[model samples]
Target: MMYPPIHLPIVKVTVLEDRALVERHAEVVLSPGAQLVRVEGLSPLAVDRSLQAQLTGGSVAQARLHRAWKQKPREGSPEGKTEPRRRVDTLEAEWKRAQVDVQRLQSRVEVVNAAREDVLRAIAEFAGAGEARPESWHEQLEAVRASTTAAEEALRQARQHAERTRQRLVEAQAALAQGEQPEPLLVTTAELQVEHPTGGSVSLRLTYLVPCAVWRPAYRATLASTGGGESVTLECEAVVWQRTEEEWKDVELLLSTARPTLGAAPPRLVEDWLRLRDKSEQEKHTVDVAVREEVIQKTGEGGAHQTEELPGLDDGGEALTLTARHRVTLPSNGAPHRVPLFAFTAPAVSEFVGHPEHSPLVHRVARFDNRGPAVLLAGPVELVRASGYVGRAQLKFTGVGERLALGFGSEDTLRIVRQADVKYDTQRLTGRRTRTHLVKLFLSHTGERPVRVAIEERMPVSEVEAVEVKLLEEQTRPPPTKVSEEGILRFELAAPPRSQQELTLAYAVASSAKVSGL
Candidate 1:
């Protein structure tokens, strides 16, 4: 075990898988009503471990948020590229580190709460876990009370550390949201302009923004002022938002009139603000805003007209319409007026695949090779067979990555389906041999309501490759209140009868990668 299991009077938690035991105990045992913040070291690990796994799946995964300690743009290191790092990888590592902190703080919280519970049980005259007289219970409670103080102090310090890290993360996030400069989210094709204050509205081309408000880019302002009549410097951190998804993805935004403070180290005119932080923005004037990144994205439900099981075929086809809305607050009007931008269509997945030469997000070489084994497919069931070599078989992959290659599709779907790709790391690169029992399923749907091809892992049998697959769960229609993803097709009505969705299941495993017999 990498860490110890946590125990508390209020919460006794045992670690499950990669989850932190203390946080689990708090949720299941202590039952704290207060909502735990999801920041690093705050939220429980169990919430999104699957998604976190995919973000950090690669062997070379790691996120590097530039620190002040890193020197100024030496020679080749422009805007901190001084070293460029993989983002999704870093986010995954950050999430893992955050989970560890969460476990630590939660451990302290659980211990303290358990001690508090002891005091209550003592005062309320309730029985302790083990038999104890009222006087004995009181003494036990005193002992617990003494320990609680130290636990409280420990929790406070841990929280302080987490908060400082959070501040840095926030600043980084904020800067990324700006979507400015070399860290380009989209390939810039045209020039644009932004209306500014003092200088009034000047020329700055619209480098990026969509017809669909999945990402509405707006010019931001950062003001710095001193009490005395000191020169008030100006800075702006761009903000990009998705109106439909109600999300703010991290995109680099341009920084104008930004400079480091006199006493600050590593002075650079511009820096990447991937997260938000408390910066010098006391006295600043309102500047004009530019919005873009909306596109019409229409999705088609049901499946292909055919029912033949095809390898790697997606039945939930979609259409995307790109459009943008502009809400401008001029010097004259207190209320900002809104206007609609033009509309365009994004490429469908099939189209993107068909036209690999044009599609921006997908790599041609990224293909699924079913060389391992086959998955079982019976009726509506799909599952991978059990393997003795590695204990369990699972896989995780991404149809796309974080940046906006943006021909079409919702980032939400990517977060949901492509985000959580979990496959067992059973196959060691060394000479050791292992078996992976995976199933391959081919599906085609031609129904009003898109169907879910439910899949489960089959347990191993004592003899040969024999295994039985189980029907775990199916998602025909997502919850009405669910956060709808653009990549997934939604069915407003119930699943119709007699509609067929063809499916073929294939399973595979890693028998041996080396030639030991030779």
Candidate 2:
């Protein structure tokens, strides 16, 4: 026999990068025999194969999902209206009442205008006939003027009221139009056949996966200056977007970085073969080469595995799950809602960083370590200072105990000037080409306090034996503090109040005659 449909309310939701897993729970009394139970009011986007049900004090023999149509009550029907429908009806009625008020006030204004015109006509006729004394005529004219002025004042007030009512009516009509959208009629339902020898109250939990739900990582970094030093509060949040046609009210939320749709099976492999051939007569005579910039694709920290599709924010070589600190209520409006996951505060070191080759302005930078339990995903972070929101910057994937730096904004009190000079010469006997570059940077501080600045510069790196690159240490006055193998020069400087500092860098590039492009 078929039993009555049960009411299962959503209790928990686990949101992933592309979908969500919803769980519902309910308890009902059942008879001590086999019966069919149905649970309705599920989102139509629920996956059929992902439906699972568990029961206590009983066992489920079979469970299947099917689409069911739920017809809504028509306008003015006996059944009650839904919340949105009721709101639309209320606004519509208010709009009609407002329209009536405007019409009545407009009629009052018209009547006042017509009466004033009639009184003026009567006064004109009486003056033309000359049937009264001058004083009497004057008194009648004065009375007519007084009454006409009163009528005009009343008309002006009535017109103002009408205009206000008209505006309110327009607003009400707009609200009604916005709330009149039709809701979906189709819904997914689960039907389960159960068996119980002796049943009283059976608790059931239903879980299913639904699409149209996605989440991404977001952060907010607030830098505060204290007596001890500067500290940064990094707040991690998840921005969720869903249109599952079901409201998750006060449900436990769990955000995951797993992509179940991609599957776990490895990709198919294909054989790769390499072959070599002898050079032609034209290539053997001279070596042909060209120089071009190479583009590098960043796969994240530790070089995460590459996928066919673009990587997500949490594509940092591992998967992680984070639970919300508090229960969340998210509506299915297809808009983004932020849920706070966790936050941590750490001591930050503030410094000014400059790359004169790119920009003349120096940026205020903050360095801090991630002391949180989980890895911080790469995403856009909103930077806040003591004054207010400074700017926005991107935070790379950072693991526990790893340090990261963010730039708040450009420092206006500090200025940088950069100049470069280049010279090319050819050796008389060797025919070797040499290019020399002399670079200078001037930093000026206008503030009352001393500040430390870090400068970065890049030098060309050669990968071929025919090309040589060297840094002229003797020629460069006050040389760089450190130089990386990849040809990056770093300089640290201290600028006192109202003082100036200068730095110079000299480099040379020598290419052999066989190197066609230098």
Candidate 3:
């Protein structure tokens, strides 16, 4: 039986990385009788078991959702198949016209060829059997030659026109073929049979899990530093995309990271055996088989929509949830829509870092702590300094009170020149060798603002007891901070405007058996 269409407007959406849970609200005015109320406009990809209805001011003893494909009417139906049929008719007409044009051009080409052959035959007859004449014969021969050449050119032009017409016909035929495809049988409604006790203007909420809706986390970090406060500000944002064949207008949007396709059950384990291979074996056996399998299962209720506690979340715990502060409207056109989730500023220290072994350029780095209550998810972060957009970096999952360093870009105002020298000496009596290495770093800050620079240097760790390495404290400048036992030295330097500073590091390696690496 054909029932009246139910209008269900999306109310809330819980978006995951690749899927979303959609909820809709609709009010039905019943006549205080028992009847089947059908809810239309649900996603065709919606899980059948996930279809649920919660009613207020009424009680339902039995509830079931029936999904069926409804055929299109001969008249204008909601499926909108008339436009495609019209397009197919138009393409067919154009294709027929193109075919007629091609045929006409081909006929013209044949006529031109016939005329050329006739001229050639006339010229051959006149040259072979006709009597020898003077000026009149020469004039006639020239006329025949000119006519023959014109006829041949006309034939070539006609053939080219025919080819062009054929190409048009091919294109039109392809378009007509595409347009002639049968209209898909789409599921337009889900008839809900609810055994109601008593119904009177009930507000019904229908929730379902649909595929093709996804949301990903994107961040934007904007830095602002006056060079005297020793702190920088950071901002973050998110981008979401959905195409669930339903418009979420003025809806509460909640984003989560969940995998529904993997199902609630864990994966089954397969046995794997390890065997020793024979070095001289060169035999193999192979088998091939074709198999096709399909399994359909009803999906249970997905994750819930997150409302609060999103601001104080750390990287640990269960899945995180971020809710939009305001209502969001996303059409079912499969497009990316950006929404500002939250923005907070944190204090950061800006410094310049350099690695002389990789490049001579110094990169601007920002060391910031997650002082805010919200945990920043791992995603691509675009960095923008006070000057302009510097570069892009990846923001790993950071918890509260966790420190992170991000590279802003290369700095040209700070210049670093590194020089190194190595000398080796051997002791003949003990068969020991001493290798001395000295490194000099010249740092110049030409900018108008003073900056902090951190230089990282690496020292070789002795793997054997016969090798001993020592750092010369008298020759080194600026004490190291938090040096690791694995031979890593970090030095923090304060660079003033228009000033140059020199840093020296010297280390000696002594090995009893003359080590190859120093």
**TM-score top scorer:** 2
lDDT of 3: 0.70
* Per-model TM-score on C-alpha atoms: 0.17, 0.77, 0.63
lDDT of 1: 0.27
Clash number for model 2? 0
Candidate 2: give its CA RMSD in angstroms.
7.6
Per-residue lDDT for 247-268 in model 1, tens only?
1112212211111111436656
RMSD of 3: 13.7
In model 1, what is the error at residue 209, expressed in angstroms? 40
Q: In terms of TM-score, which candidate is stronger, 1 or 2?
A: 2
Give the Cα lDDT of each candidate: 0.27, 0.83, 0.70
Candidate 2, residues 1-518: lDDT per residue as tens digits? 78878879999999988899999998888888898989998888999999998989788999989796766545776365556556556666755666676566667656666766776677688778985466765676676677667666765666676566667656756766687565558867799898888988878899999999999889999989988999999999999999999999999999998777766678899999999999886666454555665433343322223444656645565678899999999999999999999999999998899999989999988888888878888788999988899899877777788787888889889999999999999988888889999999999999999988999888888887778889999988677889977677989999999999889999999987656756
Question: Between prediction 2 and prediction 3, which has the larger lDDT?
Answer: 2
- Please write out the lDDT profile of model 3 over residues 1-518, one tens digit for every residue: 23476878888999876678888887777656556677777777787777777778665444455567665445455555455556555656755666665566567556656765675676678678865555665676576667657656665665665566567556766765786564555664656655445656778788878888776667777767664654645555557777776788899999876545534566789999999985432232211222223222111111122224343222344577888878988888888898778776677777788876557778977777777556667667888877888888777666666677777889889888899999999888976888898998898889999988888887776656667888878888866775767677888889999999998888898876434433
Error of 3 at 362 (Å): 2.1
RMSD to native for every prediction? Answer: 35.4, 7.6, 13.7
If ranked by TM-score, best first, what sequence of candidates would result?
Answer: 2, 3, 1
TM-score of 3: 0.63
User: What is the Cα-based lDDT of residue 239 in candidate 2?
Assistant: 94
